[model samples]
Target: MEMQVWASLFGVILGGLLSYLAQFTTVRLAARNEEKRQAAQRAEARRSERLELLREFIAITQAGIRIAEERDQAPDWDAAGTPEWFAAARNIIDRLWVAERMIEVLFSPQMYQLARAYASAVDHVLWRLPEQIAAEGSMWDHLRGPQHEFLAGARTDVGSLP
Candidate 1:
């Protein structure tokens, strides 16, 4: 009877230890999975934010390019200095300044540099419009290289996200 009691006690103890280990492992795995899920959510949120920022910045840049193109095509250089023209140009520059600052804050150093170059190219063209000096080609040509470089950099930056 004593032997029977000892054997039963050993079996019960071993079973309880195994049950505890299983529960511990399950809880750890669940916690790890939760952490991974939350990390993925955060990454996705960041990617979305970057995409919106790029979209807004690109739209503003295009608007600036259009204004520069119109100025380039204008026949009357005197009209370029009108208050209305200055107001429009000022508005574009203000928006571009904001966009540039946002890019500088949110993006990598290389991305910010690329954005700055593109913005500067556009600004140069706009400022040159009032002088009536024709470049060898369209003023938009000045923006093409910097725009392409910035776009490529943006694509790379966005695509690298998880």
Candidate 2:
């Protein structure tokens, strides 16, 4: 009789400990999963923002190229750096800067650095734009390289452009 009682008590204690351990483990796993999910969401948001920024840069670049192509020729020879194109390029650079900050905020440090580099390259090309276009040469030919680079980098997101 005494042996039976001790066995029952031991069983109860073992069951309680097992249950507690299982619950604790499950909670830890749940927390870990939530953290992963949150990080993935943040990373995805950063990628999307980067894609959008690239698209904007491409559009602005293309627009400037278009203006130069359309309005510049032998007799017309509009200064490639018209106020309108400058305003457009400036807006693009401003937006690119803002997007870079957002990427820094949302992406992992490595990804943020890579994206920053890409944005900077695109910005540099766009910024040098007016001078490159106006300096005794038509810009259309010069624009092709940067235009291709930006468009290629942004291809996944560029499909949505109308």
Which numbered prediction scores highest in TM-score against the true structure?
1
Give per-residue CA lDDT, model 1, range 75-118, as digits (tens): 87767567887899899999998999899988899999999999
Q: Which ten residues in a row have the lowest lDDT in candidate 1?
A: 129-138
lDDT of each: 0.87, 0.60
What lDDT tens digits, residue by residue, belong to model 2 across residues 1-162? 999999999999999999999999999999999999999898777667766655554454455444435445425434655787778667766766676676567434654565465556555445543456567354445545545554454463335432
By summed lDDT, the worst window of 10 consecutive residues in model 2 runs over 153-162
Clashes of each: 0, 0
RMSD of each: 2.0, 6.3
Candidate with top lDDT is 1
